[model samples]
Every structure is written in structure tokens, then in C-alpha cells.
Target: MAAASLNVENVTGLLQDCLSKLGFEVYPLKVGWYNSVLSPSLRLPFPDDSLAVVVLSTPAMFEQAFLPFMEQRGCQGLSDPIDQCVKHCATSAVSQCFPGQNVDVRYDYELLPSRKPKFLAQTAAHVSGAAFYYQQSDVTDQPWAEKKMFGVCVHPRFGGWFAIRALLVFEDVVVGSEVVQPVPPDCVPTREGRIQLLESFNFHWQDWSYRNIICPVQTYSQKQRDYFSARPAERFALLRTWGFLPKEDHQPDISSDAQSEMITHG
Candidate 1:
């Protein structure tokens, strides 16, 4: 299993197997190769032609392995439950799949202090040779925002129920262009049209309100819709009861004024 000999299919299969074992459905969002000699503007930790970046995402699927651990720690050790789970699962997967290989795994929030806010977009573009865009950030010119829903990134299939999990950097790996392509422009709706649609639906943006109306993609699953439709408080309570959060402070927005603000705004 030499690094250069490993193709896209091989790596993809390996990742799928490893992550599925941890109760996650792996989605290969983007794949790109880094050539330092060709693109000097792209700064990477590895040398030219030695690194390949794979942007992987996952839905909100809770792993049973985390239950016992969460029961004891109560999500106190990590800032985000999803991040913790993704990082742990990815690290384990890489170790098992590529024994003795050099791989660097990084999450969305694990950027260095010196890194810029749009580091994810920059890195993805540099590696894949395609433009990338994300909502709530001034990173790239690509318009991928669902303006009706507070400007969150929306995928054609998963909609808002999925999250960008991590960037898996493989040293000395080669990925083909066939497996890597720019995200479809049609996936993002126009800002003006989305705003008009929101207005028509009588949706209002509220500060810290439990319910906010946003149009989902046509391909969004019914299960995903149901999950996002629940009130924030109810969702938080359920997570706490499932040992995903501390029992005493089940709510994420801890400020005492939060309830009052929600009431006033709602």
C-alpha cells in the first residue's frame, strides 16, 4: 500500500469503511491535489505534489460509542459535540486505513490562531483548483448562501442538516480531476429571490429566537426536516437527556436574559 499507488477509489473505500464503523455516513464534498511549483500562493504544510486535500462532510448521526463517554463527561470536555465526534472518528479511521502513512487531519474550528477566517475556503480552492464559497464568511466570491435562512450553506441533497467535518490531507497521494469538480452553481439560490421568498412566507429574522423559517432544498430528507423543525429548547433537552450535554445546564445559550430576549423577539 504505497502512498503514490493509492488511487481515489482505494482511499475513498478506506475512508467509507473506517467512518461507517463509527456510525457516520461519509460524503466526499471535494477533492484536490496540491502542486507547490505551480501554485505558490497556496500555502500548505506539505511539499509540492506530495499532498492531496479531501473535504469530507457528515450528517448529524450520533455514534453509540460516544454514549458511555458522554454519560461521564456530559459534553464538558469539548466545545462542540459534532466536532469532537468527527475528529475522534477521523483520526481513528486514518490510523487504521493508512498505517505508517503521513496524514494530517484538521477540523473547521481547529485552525491556528494566525490563520484567517476563510481558511477553509482558501485551502479547499488551492487543493482542488476550483472556487469554494461558504455562508457567514467573506472568503470567496462564490455565492452559496441561502439568504432566507440566515445565510447558511445549503447542499442540494443534505440541505442544512449536514456539516463540513474535516480536511484529510494525504501525503504523497495523487487524485484525478474526474473525482474533483467545482460545486454546482445551481446549488445556491440568488440572494434577492431568497429574500423575496422569505418575505412571501412571512418569515422574520429574530435574535436568538427558537424558530426561524428557511426554505430547504427539494432533495432534503423528511427525517432531516423533522429534526430541524423541533424547537431549540426541545432539541437541547433531548440531547441532555441522551447524555449529550450537562444535565444542569441543558441549554446552550446560558445567559439568563436569553429567555427574555427570545420572548421579546418572538
Candidate 2:
């Protein structure tokens, strides 16, 4: 939550730490490698409850992310269109467990309006299959600036390809709630809440400073708000209804070569 954009290293480390504390041994399994057919109905090594949490960042849906390639290798991490990772993840979760093993998977999915279905499925899967999943929406809705800001750490010239910040939250009472700080008049609720949570969370930047943070700018208009508000619980219910281990259509036309080229070139 600390201004540093989410990355694989940070996410894995955080989950490892969290799981270790929760008395669960974390095992890093290649989702694609284990599931050769990309279908959830398959034999897996670990028991259902063995997997305490599955941290997914939803990086696959990004047109330029390495996710599509991951899926192409027979992994359910990503499939055609990329927005169905959560759906597939749910399938994997249900399939990985025993007949009635109560295992849950958690995802730190990136928040994207275009990938709302993925986001919704993540939540709904947890509700339906009884898995634990969480998504971190982008700081702002603006595309260009968010891309640039996130690209900074991913850029080679910045002398930094990535950074991660870790924070600790003690289960104690919060202080000085009576004297809350003033908020902007036109400030949006989601953005304000994100900023507030970021500030409250204690995180350490792996290789970047928080001061030079280039946060994502909001782009949601009145119409967008109306749409989101209107269908707030839509994705959750929709995904839950999809159920676990549902049938999937193989889209042979969609190739991973395009994604590989994009992530490598830009």
C-alpha cells in the first residue's frame, strides 16, 4: 500500500510473511506448470487446505503483461481475453482441493475498470467457493499517467526495474479519530479511502522513495460513477453463479506471441 506500485516480488514476499504468521507454510507453485491443460479438474500435489492463500495480482489481463504468455503454457493463470483469470483461479481452487476440503485463495488483483469481471470473479469466487481473495484497485482512474508512473520502476533507465514496500499493522486501537484531517470538497470516496489506507499502512520501499511518488490520477466521470454504483454487486454475484470448475472454450486463434512481443518491446 505504500506508494510503490505492486510487483511480483513484493506480493510474494508479503504473502509469504502473512502466511507464515498465520501458521501456514507457503508453497510457491507454478499455476501453469502444474495444470498442463489449463483446466482446474486435475491432480495436484498439495492438499486443498495446504494452500492457505493464492496471491494473484491480475497482471495477466494487461495487454502488455506477461500473463497471456503464462496462460499459453497451459496455465489457468490467464486465458484468452485475460479477464477470466479470477474465474479460472476459482476453478483451480475448487479442483485443487479434495472433495470437501475447505481451502481458500487470496488475490491482490489490480483494479482496472476494463477488468472489472476479473475483479468481481475474485470476490465472488471467494464468496461462492469459500476462498479468500482481495484486489487492490489503482490509485486513480487516469490511464496515461498511471501507466507512466508504474512504468518508471519497470523502466531500465531509471536504474530500477522494481521496488516493494512492506508495512506492519498492529492489532491495536487507532489514535486521534476525533480530530480527523480535512478532506477536499470534490474528492472522490474511493480515491480518498485509498490514500487514507496507504497512509495508514506501514510499508517499506525496496528500491524507491515514497516522496517522489507519481500517483494515478482519477478519470472517472459522473457517468462512470453512475455505472459503477448501479452495478456494485453485479460482478460478485455473477462470478459466484458461474460456480467452480465450469466448462471453458478453447480459443485457439488467440496466441501468446502478441503478448510476449508487447511485454518485451514496451
The candidate maximizing TM-score is 1
Query: Model 1, clash count?
Result: 0
Residue-level error in angstroms, candidate 1, position 128: 5.8
Model 1's lDDT to the true fold? 0.47
Best by lDDT: 1
Error of 1 at 190 (Å): 5.3
Per-residue lDDT of model 1, residues 1-266, tens digit only: 78867875687688877765554444333333433323444455564444444444433344343444455445554244445556666787888889888877766656566564223533453335322233333323424455523333333444333444566767658545456444433343565544433332224323212122233333224443433344444545666665566667736653333332222111
Clashing pairs in 2: 32-75, 165-204, 166-203, 166-204, 167-202
How high is each candidate's TM-score?
A: 0.57, 0.21
Name the runs in model 1 displaced over 4 angstroms: 20-42, 47-57, 63-78, 115-118, 121-152, 176-185, 189-239, 243-266
lDDT of each: 0.47, 0.28
State, as a TM-score between 0 and 1, how close model 2 is to the true structure.
Answer: 0.21
Candidate 2, after superposition: displacement of residue 78 in Å? 15
